[model samples]
Target: MKLNSDYWEDRYQNNEIGWNVGKITTPIKNYIDQLKDKTIRILIPGAGNGYEFEYLIHKGFKNVFVVDFASTPLENIKIRIPNLDKNQLILSDFFELEGKYDLIIEQTFFCAIKPNLRENYVHKMNSLLNPKGKLAGLLFQFPLSENGPPFGGSIQEYKKLFEADFKIKYLEIAYNSIKSRKDNELFFIFLLK
Candidate 1:
């Protein structure tokens, strides 16, 4: 139940990452495609396998970065994108990480952590973003229960959780989620308040 570095590393070694989609999900990819700036600093916390990281780089995004405590996925990224800057692939706890970014891309990291850490995750995300920066991506939408690393949440819950620190620009069921996640995901964009 301790979702620490070793736990994640073991998941990778065992190929137990059920949350990984093996490729960037459509909602996130569409979001990135609409972005006109390629130089903005971006961070992808809990970047398991880094499909999004690779997608951004391949699309000419220069300041993209990824942070994951597990060395396995970070190493996987290095092997997949041989020319990627090593410093941009940080192998460290997301909470302990420092530096301001214009954007932080969230996928499944929020659910992977214990539910008790949800508030801390929001604060940490707010701290890592520069003024007016955004935290954008998909969040799973389902009844919150005791069974998951792929924990589920509702739109109303998310609104209360982020509205204090972020201007919730968008939060609704994702219209273009991958088939597997169709009605189960919510695409959101929250700008720093």
Candidate 2:
């Protein structure tokens, strides 16, 4: 019931990660493609296997970082991305992490946490970012219900949750989601307010 580090670690250890897309998702890929500054510091929290982290490195973004409390997935990412900077592959709980970044990439992480921590998550995200820094990625688009790690949510709910700390730059149905998530995801870009 509690989606803590142990819960996520077990999912990776047992190979039960349905959310591991194996590669960067389309919406995230597209968003990265348009970024003009390779120097911007980027953080990818709850990054399982970290395809996006590798992609950013390959694209010449030197300050990209990935944080996850689970060792298995972080190890997998290190193995897969052989050239990854040791400092960039952080092994720590997302909420407990420190340092400011220009951007944060969200994927399945938002849904993995218990709903009660939503406000804390938002506050932590705001704290991790530099002034005017952005948070961008996909959010599952559906009704919020009790049953899930991949908990679903509506745009209205997302707006209410993030509006207090971020300027919602873009939040809409992601046109580039992978086939399985086509109509079920929202691509969002929010700047620290």
Q: For each candidate, give its TM-score against the true structure.
A: 0.98, 0.97
lDDT: which candidate is best? Answer: 1
Instruction: Please list the residue runs of candidate 1 whose C-alpha ends up more than 4 Å from where it truly belongs after superposition.
Output: none
Off by over 4 Å in 2: none
**TM-score for model 2?**
0.97
How many clashing pairs does model 1 include?
0
Q: Itemize residue pairs with steric clashes in candidate 2.
A: none
Worst 10 residues of 2 by lDDT: 77-86
Clashes of 2: 0
lDDT of each: 0.93, 0.91
